[model samples]
Target: MSKLVEEFNDYRTRMNEVILSKNNLVMKRLWNLDTNTYEEGALDKKTKEMLGLVASMVLRCDDCIKYHLGKSYELGVTTEQMYEIFAVANIVGGTIVIPHTRRAAEYWEELQTNAQ
Candidate 1:
């Protein structure tokens, strides 16, 4: 697995364990809902992942960016598609997204390289 994906899975596993152990019905339900929303839908999984990446960039959430970028790559989002996502992030987030966008771009390239 790509390092980012590995990290994300590790984090997800840990978080899921905590939520389940706590018996937090709301948290578990929210997680399930989030997962369902991201699955193939009217917008398609790839587009949703791309949009997730853009939102992650705008939110300056590295973990979110890593997760979404990995998903986007897994869904066969091309470098061109990634660049367009970055453009959207830039437009909506302005300069604040620069660092996040740069990190996401680097992670995206790394994922592509590992796949090759």
Candidate 2:
């Protein structure tokens, strides 16, 4: 795996471990809600993940961005689509999104490189 993917997986693994072992009472419910939110319904899972990516960027949540980006890739969201989403994030989030966008772009490039 690329460094970006490795980092994302490591972060997710650690967070899951912590939540499952130490914070299950409240964290498990929150995690479950999050899991449920990504299910296909009125909006497809891919669209929901794209929206989640937008929300993550606007909220300046790196972990959330990584998770959503990973899901978007898993769901076959294209790099072009990601550029559009980043554009939306840039418009909605302004200068605050610069760093997050940079990080996301780097991860996307890493994913592409590894795929090739």
Candidate 3:
């Protein structure tokens, strides 16, 4: 498998473990609910991915942003959509998102370079 694919799988596995293990109480409380399902009604996959990308970016999780950006693109998210995601990120995550926004952009650019 390609290194990128392998790394993504590793991240997936670890994220799953963290969720299952209740690595953080907030994670368990907020995301691990039984009502949590992929049923986003009419929400398209790209929209959901865009939401995730914004969240990861605002949260300053490079690993998460990298994975979600790849997933978002695979789901047909355009660069324009990414810009929208950034806007929503700032709106939702607020001032603390400034630093994370910079870092996420750096990580995203790094990933693009590595892919070349």
lDDT sort, best first: 2, 1, 3
The predicted structure with the larger lDDT, 2 or 3, is: 2
Residues 24-91, model 1: lDDT tens digits: 88988998998999988789998898888888888899988888887888788889978999999999
**TM-scores for all candidates?**
0.88, 0.93, 0.57
Better by TM-score, candidate 3 or 1: 1
Q: Which candidate number has the best TM-score?
A: 2
Worst 10 residues of 3 by lDDT: 32-41
Model 1 misplaced stretches (Cα beyond 4 Å): 2-5
**TM-score of candidate 1 against the unseen true structure:** 0.88
Number of residue pairs clashing in candidate 2, backbone atoms closer than 3 angstroms, sequence gap of 3 or more or interchain: 0
Higher-scoring candidate on lDDT, 1 or 2: 2
Model 3: lDDT equals: 0.69
Model 3: per-residue Cα lDDT over 8-110, one tens digit each: 7788889778776866877666664522433355886667777778878777787777778777656666666676787889898898877777766655555
